[model samples]
Target: MPSATYASRRSELETYFDRTAVEAWARLTSDAPVSRIRATVRAGREAMRAELLSWLPQDLSGRRILDAGCGTGAFSLEAARRGAEVVAVDVSPTLIGLARARAADPGLPGRLDFRVGDMLDAALGRFDHVVAMDSLIHYRSGDIVRALAQLAARTDRSLLFTVAPRTPLLTLMHAVGRLFPRGDRAPAIEPVAEGSLRRRIAREAALAPLAVARSRRIARGFYLSQALELARR
Candidate 1:
């Protein structure tokens, strides 16, 4: 039950990813001696992994799980390793391909499924858990409610995600950075406030806020605020 605007936004995002995903992956995997790209990705994923593992229920053996916006398969792969039937979806073909290749590795083969699709349009079926880490920031302010509804519809148990804290200073920084000639590619540009975020989530889905962890600066320029919520449906 996504709105027309939501669908259109999803399409635009998919198109952007289709155009840039391969190049993004290439940069991530580049052989440049000065590059810390892969290490940064791994460290960020590890932090997210720890948070998710700590909040999730035990005895998830054989449960169905959906990883929405599953960039590079970090959370999705971990769920598969925990014996969940995992379907990982991302708008980027390159990211999905990388995830598939990672799944084909000896340890994770046949345990995960990766697909190039919008989280808003994918028929994800009923999942015991849904994860969207550091992904919702891409949504425009008005679209957050619809996006949360779409995500909640795909799951019956729990949903976990992270957002950049909505602070006046952070907002000002994003605005100023965007105006700078050389700050266009800066990492700390997107953030959402918790109050507005919670209101949107509540409007779109029957949900109970479980926990909100303090913002943790994970890498050179990225900061994350972890939230664990239960689907009340």
Candidate 2:
């Protein structure tokens, strides 16, 4: 059973993202609405996705990739375009529908598959690489660790995912932001003792960390986002 925190986070994500996938992707800065932002935010998000893809290599031809929690199919479709077979999974049927719409191209049909499944309950098949991108942001620590182990088991090469690091500065920012949050935008973060969590995940999942880099898009004082790459044992 999913914890209350995990279930609440899933509900919030499904409610917010399902209604505005495109708008969310075009985030100008922090949590500002799309109408109040510039085109650069969209480009920035694309760049971040590119960075996420960078963990692998220049060429992904003939590779099998799992884009777990893929939102609107951005990274998943990109992988397909680069000659990889991708399985794109997400929890929101609305978001999955949007992804399916994007995969309508004649050339993309054979390259990828899109499905709706929660991270905790999904039965993912084997793959050369697994990436969760920023989708695990609000997940509970225990669930995240469980997902990591399962991802590690199915992946032949490596697994990549993002986490919201807890720092003193970020802790302060979140506290203040909550008092005066913008409209219905999500909180900057909830505390994730990143160091201890990393250690715990490594111990429980039997995976070794390859790299942990701060994401340029969300590493400001508000959200100290880090992309973690774990290699299979």
Candidate 3:
């Protein structure tokens, strides 16, 4: 079960993505031109996604993958194209709708089963690999470890996720973001120290079967996030 804090944060995220910043998010994930700041974010996200994908096999023909917190479904689409059965899920109905709309092409290879719900839902079943992208960036370190533990329970091979890396620049930008009017502000990202996160993961009993495999930080202009991989031992 998710802790109360996790549930609350999930609600905040659903509202932010479904109602508050749906248009802005859609624009950011698309080819449509965006402001310079968003362009950097898009680029950074692309780089991170590519890095995560590179960790998986290029030919995923019998694999079952989970695209947890899948936003506009770019990563899910790619995984599906590589012949993985992908269950791309998100808490935002609007974002899921956009993903479904974008993936309407009948000729796309493999299958993309997009759902609107918590990515930690056990009903979603097991996966050979799970990619969380930037989904867990808003939660605290403990909550992140807990969430990963939950996902790790059903993940057979590996789990790929990203966190807002604690850094001078990111800390400054995060503080500045708080100054924005509450209504216009996105939910604050919770920057995490990589060392602390790794320690917590190590202490998590549910995560004991997984070992930290690979990690890389991607920082593009206003965007900064670290991708971490945990594979079954």
Candidate 4:
């Protein structure tokens, strides 16, 4: 079960993405022109997506994968092309609609499932691998770990996710972001120290069956996030 804090954060995220930043997000995910800041973010996200895909097997035929918080479904589409059964889910109906629209490419394999709901829902079923890119940055450390624990329970082989790594640059960015107009700003990200996060994950009883496999940090201009992979032992 999701804690009160987790549920609250999820609600806030849904509101922000579904109502506040729909067009902005859609533009960011497309090739259309964007400001320099968002361009850096787009580039950083692309790099991070590639990094995570590189960690997965090249031939994913017959594997089940979950694209948790899949925004616009770029990663999910690629994973499906690689022959994985990809279930791409997010909390925002608007974003999921956009993802479905983009997924109309008939060339893609017939295995991509797009839905709007909590990615932690058991109804989504188990997976061979799960990829959550830039999805947990808004939650507190404890909530983030609990979310991972729930995902770990259902994930069979690996779980890959990203977080807002606590760093001086990210802290400065957060402060600057607050200066933007309230209507234009994204939810404040929760920056966490990587060491502390690792320690917390190690101590969490529900996540005991999984071990940290690898991690990498992606930093570009205004974008800074860390990807961690947990593999079942």
Candidate 5:
């Protein structure tokens, strides 16, 4: 079962995405040459790409993949373009709708499946690879472990994700930012410490660390860490 806080936050995130999807779609589609547009969009997700690629097996040519919290289907589209069957899910209906529209416009509706669903839901089946990037930070400290366990359980190969690192300076900055009005700044989600995150991964089962990269360059002033874990199972 999902916690009340998790559900509430998910609702808030969905609302935000619904309001911004149109603008996001316009921006994502502005560049000429779909490949160029994809590269530009992926520039913001390079850290995620690097870490996720490190954990995946060398050959993914016909394997099925699950992209949890696949906002806008950037990674899912990339994987599908690489020859993998992809099922991309997100809690936001608007984002999934936009993804579906993009796929259809390119005549790739058959290659990708986008759904609106929660990560904690087990109805989604196991896959060769499962990725959740920049999504785990929405959960409070205790919920992360459960989320990671659920992700691992749904994947036979690997689970890849990124989290905002919990450093003292970063924590202080978040605290200060929260004291101001909402319109003045974005609310920063509290990040988990590296040690605590490692412990959570351990609780799920031993996870071999595959790679870690900083996302500072992609998004301005954001101190985030991308991590890949190969599930022991």
Candidate 6:
């Protein structure tokens, strides 16, 4: 079971996303539902997703994938569309509900098992790949160490997720961005020192990085993203 503090923080994050990011998250960035204020952020996500998906096998004909912390199911939908079986999960019921509805629509051709649960604690089966998008922002550095270990355990092929890179400039930017504030939001950005994060995971988790790329560059948002691609021990 997750601790009370974990549960509370998780709830706060879910509420924040459900209220703010979900609408834009559910839509393709080119679509009008993404606000001008949100478009740049959404664009960064879109770019990140496209690049990461390209890392998958050329033929994902019957691969199994886990989409941990799948918000609004954008990546889940895309993976399914590309012919992978996806188990998409989120801590937020609201986001899972949206994803379930989207997956249920007759036009989509893919198998999605959408569930609402804590990724760290879920008893989900193994998969060929595990892709967790921008979900690690919810965790502090210590918490993220645990989360990455779990993700590393479940994937036979590869695991991928994004983290805020802790550069002096980006750290300053995150602090500055928080001041403007979303009315219902609690502070969520947890930037990790790229060097330290890689070293720690290598030493502790034993999940070696196949590739680590900066997906969302400084131009996109105050929060920059680095996508870590890890392989089994």
Q: Cα deviation of 23 in candidate 4 (Å)?
A: 0.9
**Tens-digit lDDT track of model 4 for 50-125:** 9999999988999999999998999998898888999999999999999999888778654889999999999999
lDDT of each: 0.63, 0.69, 0.94, 0.93, 0.66, 0.73
Q: Across residues 1-233, which tens digit of lDDT does each residue of candidate 5 receive?
A: 77787777787667666664546544553343435545555455664565576556555676788888887777787777666778899887877877777666364432687889886678878787788877777667677766766666667666666666777766787789888976554425766777776666555542333222222222323434535454544
Give me the displacement of residue 134 in model 4, in angstroms.
0.5
Model 6 compared with the native: what TM-score?
0.83
| Residue 114, model 6: Cα distance from true site in angstroms | 0.9
Report how far residue 87 has shifted in candidate 6, in Å: 0.4
Per-candidate RMSD, Å? 4.1, 4.4, 1.0, 1.5, 5.0, 3.3
* Candidate 5 ranges with C-alpha deviation above 4 Å: 20-44, 105-110, 182-187, 204-223
The pairs that clash in candidate 5 are none
Q: Which digits, one per residue and each the tens of the lDDT, describe model 6 over residues 34-101? A: 55657777777877888678878755768999998888788888888887888998877878888787
Q: Candidate 3 lDDT, tens digit per residue, 64-179?
A: 99999999999999998898899999999999999999988677677999999999999999999999999999999999999999999999999999999999888888899999
Model 4 worst lDDT window (10 residues): 102-111
Arranged by lDDT with the best first, the candidates are 3, 4, 6, 2, 5, 1
lDDT of 1 at 11: 63
Model 4 ranges with Cα > 4 A deviation: 175-184
Give the per-residue lDDT of model 1 (tens digit) for 1-233: 66676666566656655564456654553333324655566456577667776666654677887788887786776677676778888887877877777666566432687877777564667777777776666555556656666666666677776666677766787787767664223333356766776666556533333323333333323444445455444
Give candidate 6's whole-model lDDT: 0.73
TM, every model? 0.76, 0.76, 0.97, 0.95, 0.77, 0.83
Per-residue lDDT tens digits for candidate 2, residues 1-233, read: 55677777787777676665545543442244454234444544555677788877657887889888887788887788778888888877877887888677777533888888875453667888888877776766776776677677678887878776677876786688778745556634565677777767757733453333333334432224667777644
- Compared with the true structure, the alpha-carbon lDDT of candidate 4 equals 0.93
